[model samples]
Target: MSSPLFTSVHVGGRQATHRVVMAPMTRARSTQPGDVPNAMNARYYSQRASAALIVTEATQVSPQGKGYSFTPGIYSPEQIAGWRLVTEAVHAEGGRIFAQLWHVGRMSHADFHNGDLPVAPSAVAFEGKIWKVDPATGKGEMVDCPTPRALDRDEIRDIVSDFRRAARNAIDAGFDGVEIHGANGYLVDQFLRTTSNVRTDEYGGSRENRLRFLKELVCEVAAEVGANRTAIRLAPFLTARGMACPDILPTILEAVEFLEAQQVAYVHLVEADWDDAPQFTEEFRRQVRARFRGTIIVAGNYDVERANWVLQHGYADLVAFGRPFVANPDLPARLAQGLPIADFDPATLFGGQDHGYTDYSPMQQAA
Candidate 1:
């Protein structure tokens, strides 16, 4: 039998031609000053339109939501106009695209907020680096994140409104839909984990409390845009960014139930792929499948065979390839033909020019 990847699937009330999804990847190439998407970004995504769905890189919902340098935003009118170009480009190529709205929370440095500390559910700080451009040198570098100021009850509500507005802005900018980035070690993820959130308020302490922020944000976004056009990304067992919680698996399972009840189009799970990363067991997969009967999109370091295997096993409805699509603009076509692909230059990945961004020729052009 032929691979199910090529089969049409209904998503967000639209029929996507294939089950190959382009995962939201952080390619920090947007224009600076305003953090707006540009023609280069439009070309970059449109080139990979063969994927059934393309989730844009994590876009800041507001200036305060920004964590990295050069990442795009959806808050300003200029930003919206910029994104419209990207959406139009992808649509012209007959592709479906969703904006991945983001709020980095404490995963940010003070420089972005005029030396003000970033806000989170708790004051805890993760032991990691965040992208920032040096004020003196104007060169981008990863800097240590300080202990963020915890958000008060009223502030939390404001952030929720920000997410809802971002969803509306995405629709106005001509996106097919929007996906709330509740995964990784960002804002929503911070609130979900016990280690990061230790407040005794209604949003902290117990598991249900930890899940409150995510639930509220999702509800706002889904209400702004129908659940059919809303989705979420979750990393259940991620530990790289100090996300290893003893009860994280069950917490995510419960979150999935909430998302399922909301009728979200899909839940994108970011699997462990780095060296010695914690394993997402088949048992866990089964549990997720049982709870979330809606579409499941799994992303790891999956190749063609692995992607097809998961789809066949009822583990995932779609597989997302990140780095592969960087060098192989026509990744779906290459995968369909079992063709070889080139590796992307690692150095040119973040805050770069057109060299590694869109210069990767298709197979025919390279030949």
Candidate 2:
């Protein structure tokens, strides 16, 4: 019997050879100062091009949008050029790739942005430490996030335009499509959650208004890249790093309704973190399948058995693997053969060299 995970499916008008996706995991290995993608980064992505679809690490749209040190960006000409090399390499492997456009919102420290204060939907500070780049040693440093300024009406408009421009730039960088980074309590998620957005304006105070920015962003970006080539990611029930969305089901249902109305390519959901927390319930999964009309992609601590189970039960159309794909470059082949998976070293997950990034041997290659 053939696994649905290995079956071909169409996403945004492009036919994917399989249903296994490489979920975007930030490696923090970008070249310094300008935050440009380099040959090493290109090789890393190219090596994992075997996935049916590869969503690159979250790339910030602008400098102020940055949160972590050494992560790449897509807002400048140099950054675009650097990403071009990565996209070209993946294309050479006959794989589809999408750029996860991101902004950290208030989840950043000034040290990461050259002493500029981080911005969010409201003037709220998260009770967590943000990782920053040391100006002197160019190393990762833990810094406290400062209070952010609430984006006014005009500022909100500019942010929406930034997303549109970023989507256009992703096309120029040779990505098959763009995935709006609405997950993990980023800018879009900040606005979506009432805990972060305290405004009484049109962008807040009601479920419809809170989701307005995301809807507009999707509509605008889809216009630039076409609805078939646009996707969005959301951490629907995530509550990490001082982020929480009350009434998760209703909020998610509302989001699904909005996405269905927009006719997006797909909605990627990070149902839960890998940790043992009850983030996504079976009822929620069924509700998503019932409400969402397009392709559904689910990520979070998923192995081959779980991936097959979800697809077989119609919970999701695809399963994205994060750490597994990072450690095992040939993750699809390993799953296909039911090979024992390798464990990823958490210590080398962030800013390491090629040791853990690209040195994982495939089952056949190792044998």
Candidate 3:
């Protein structure tokens, strides 16, 4: 029997070996001072090169875009060179990679930004705690995020340019493409949700205006690098940890239509963060599929069986595995061979060494 997981798929004219994709996961392992990608990360990504498409961890575009400690960036030359090592390592094994560009928006503390307050669509502060690294002890610290400064019109233009520069840097770093991190309550997402953006300017007040920043970013990046090499990730119905959005279906439809017009490579959607949250109904799924003519990758707590079913049923063209890929580097092979998946240690999910990052052994090694 043919396995849908192993079926070959084409994204942006490039043929992928399998339908399994490695979703971008923030490990928070990059050391401070420069946030350069190191050999350890290179090895970590190379180990999972079997994925048809490996969207890298979220990388901030500029210093002002930073939200957490130890996350990598693509703005600096040193950072670009560092990412080059990772891309080269992954490509050596014939794997395609995409860099995820990010900005934390209101989900950041001044401690990580040289005493500068984090920026957001509005001045509202995220009503939760964020994990930061304690410089004194080098351990993770839970800190309350402060209210952000609402970006002015000029600031918005500068932020878009930052994304454009980051896209250029990703290409220079040897990435096959770049995935704009428009999801998970980041800057782009802050503008999308009505609760977060209460401005009366051109960026806010209505649904169409709310999606302006993200749409402009997509167009700008697509101009820099062809639309075929650009993708966007969105968390449509996610409302947790102060990341709430009202009327998700209509908002998503608007964004999807805009993306369709741009002819982007794909639209990566995260239906909801929590399992108990409403799943994407077949009708809503069809609506998105009809709106987006390009590839569609659905993620968020999907197992092998569900992933295969979604693909075979024609709901999603590709399925992205997040925590599963972290705990199982050989996830594609395991799904192909029907091998047992090792349990993931949730305790070691963030800010860990090689214990959970690169130490997940393949089935052959375990045997």
lDDT of 3 at 187: 89
Better of 1 and 3 by TM-score: 1
Q: Any idea how many clashes model 3 has?
A: 0
Choose the strongest candidate by lDDT: 1
Please write out the lDDT profile of model 2 over residues 143-213, one tens digit for every residue: 77788878788978888888899999999999999999999878899988888888888988898888898
lDDT agreement of model 1 with the native: 0.90
Better of 2 and 3 by TM-score: 3
TM-score between candidate 2 and the true structure: 0.95
Alpha-carbon runs more than 4 Å astray in model 3: none
Which ten-residue region of model 1 has the weakest summed lDDT? 10-19
Instruction: Evaluate all candidate structures by whole-model CA lDDT and list the values in order.
Output: 0.90, 0.85, 0.87
TM-score per candidate, in order? Answer: 0.98, 0.95, 0.96
Give one digit per residue, the lDDT tens place, for model 3 in 1-367. 6778788899634798789999999898875579988888998999999898999999999988887778899998899999999999999988889999998888888887778888888997667577788878978877888999899999999999999999999999999999999988888988988888999999998888998999889999999988989999998777875666666569879999999998898999877757588666888888888888789999988887888788887889999988888878889999888898888887777786788889989889988
Pairs clashing in candidate 3?
Answer: none
lDDT of 1 by residue, 1-367 (tens): 7988777888655787778889999999988789989999999999988788999999999988989999999999999999999999999998889999999999998888999999898888678688887869878888898889999999999999999999999999999999999888899999999988898989998899999999998888888888988999999878967677888898999999999899898999999889998888999999999998999999999988888888998989999999899999998888888899789998888888899989999999999
TM-score, cand. 3: 0.96
Q: Kindly report which residue stretches of model 2 are placed more than 4 angstroms away from their true locations once superposed.
A: none
